[model samples]
Target: MTAPLAPPGLHTTSLDLGGRTALVTGAAGGIGRACALRLAGAGAKVRAVDRDAEGLAALADRARGLAGTVEPHVLDLTDLDAAELAAAGTDVLVNNAGLQLVRPVEEFPPDVFHTVLTVMVEAPFRLIRGALPHMYGQGWGRIVNVSSVHGLRASAFKSAYVTAKHGLEGLSKTVALEGAPHGVTSNCVAPAYVRTPLVEQQLTDQARAHGIPEERVLSEVLLTDSAVKRLIEPEEVAEAVAYLCAPQASFMTGTSLVLDGGWTAH
Candidate 1:
């Protein structure tokens, strides 16, 4: 007997990145980890970059059964030279490494702001620079920068994050324009309050900054603007990254694929 067809809206086509090499910074956990696994499942050799050595090892182990491979590359994005070198030969680049500090502009530490910009903006620029030669030579590449709702909208006590994301958004658009003729597509996946370690830590930080209890932080701050009233899963954001890397998204360049749960609608 023949099997029943998939229902409407079901995704039957798999994203195939076989033979491609993908580099995902901050791949030790959260959205970066999910994106690495998703690309590996699509048969792309994933270079998982993170300062967390043990976490990368664990990620590699978990990716063992996937269609492709996950190779751990322990490198801190703060090391600009090394970070750029690491992106060499990569066919797909996912600049997902980031750091966040919750504090008012007046109270925000200068060092932390520099660190955030280094990892989120400067490092990504170098990685893109290093990866461009190969991509342009081959006439094809994918660059997905994992931005955030803060990139488009500002929030109190998140000065550094907002600034860094806004810088990244501009960088993504510039890359898109420059890379278009070379068959490379550059874009940003902007998601709000993803259920990740970063957001978990932000709960406490937000509470402290907002003068609210920890439990109240979720409802009062985090989910207050979210129409969906829930945190987005890392896997959901990973699907967006995968789609951007897929051949089907060739024409979708220089745009923010926002998964903000209507946060930007207001």
Candidate 2:
């Protein structure tokens, strides 16, 4: 029998975002951390925003030696006013901060659902509002929303997360439409279960919620619809964000760049 050949290697970009100011929420870890570092690598001054002060500090340490600087801005996304202020003067905005509580709507706490919506949807709206004046004045900007496969598909016992992501999709599109004339582009990067701290915590929560063992959660709950039976890497998703911010993607707006490992193919 003939041996099978390897598939083509994935290619990355060397985008130059020099002299740009980028604000990335949830920049302390996971996809946010990767995005912060990647933007810095492309020569942008990055404002890394997150609630975890210590995590943000560690991220700054790791960001050393990149082509640009990373200024850690420690703040919780729940503070809507502060979130809007922090987004001011940004040439690129990545709304990546979010919270999740997986439970049936009937069983899920209403307060938790509200918090998720506030952080994932409302805060993004405020941030975009803050960033627009600067972008419009300069006649250029990029906004990338870190949505999820859940934004396009529904999964059980994840009412809060699903609702928030779907709402985010709408928010991104609205921003895209409004900002088009001002030389700003808005889009969403929807990824399936990227290996992140949030998702790691979900493994435990999902296990408890479903009464299943933690080990089985990855296969049964997370990757059930993914044709590629592996969690996505944060760097891979970050690369997509970078691509959206690059000059080549200026014409690409009001669209969802999905990195779902074929989860949505069905």
Candidate 3:
């Protein structure tokens, strides 16, 4: 949804934020780590939240190298109170925690589906609700929901993942609409497959299920859907998140920046 135009060069106004706080969920690994690191580099104090305690420590150590400080909070986002506490007083919120469970709809387990929905869809909404008051009161904020290419398009054997991501996109749009007037912006970065521990696990599982080598899963299943024929890099996704949080993006909200390597093009 587009808002009325402001004067030219309006988006470039820098926040000069040296100590502004930001909370990044799922910050211990993959895109979450990258997003937290990028925001920290931009001079924001980061509260890195993830269930993986060891991974969270590593991330906190990494953040020490950057100018901004990072405090790791090991907690499950499924707990609404924990999510709220982790999100409080933050100027930016990145809902990057999610998992992919591949199975035909007919065979998908209800418990697994519910777990995916809880993290991907429900937790994000809860986080936005918790963070909105502080953001609106300050008249400035950014909320970046890390969705997937599957959010916009679907594939076989991933009914639950696709459904949850689609729901996330809708939730982000609604937040954008409601947060716009208060100088808060919400957006989604929908990226194709990236090489991470999660993807590695998926590859192994796919190989076992299809009776093929794990190496083949990349070219046969994953890359086959991408025009670039390569996995999107974590840094690339991190850069997109940074751009969305930049002062230049104040006027950009409720939009999906699709980094699918032309997967949806066809």
Q: Which one is best on lDDT?
A: 1
> Weakest 10 consecutive residues, lDDT, candidate 1?
1-10
Error of 2 at 43 (Å): 0.4
- Listed per candidate, the RMSD to the true structure in angstroms reads 5.4, 3.6, 7.0
Cα miss at 47, model 1 (Å)? 0.4
TM-score, each model? 0.95, 0.95, 0.92
Tens-place lDDT per residue, model 2, 153-252, is 9998899889999999999999999999999999999999888888878988789888998888988888889887788888889999999998899999
Compute the lDDT for candidate 1: 0.93
Q: Of the pair 2 and 3, which is ahead by TM-score? A: 2
lDDT per residue as tens, model 1, 69-137: 999999999999999999999999999999889998999999999999999999999999999999999
- C-alpha lDDT values of all predictions: 0.93, 0.91, 0.85
- Candidate 2 lands at a TM-score of 0.95
Model 1: residues >4 Å from true position, as ranges? Answer: 1-13
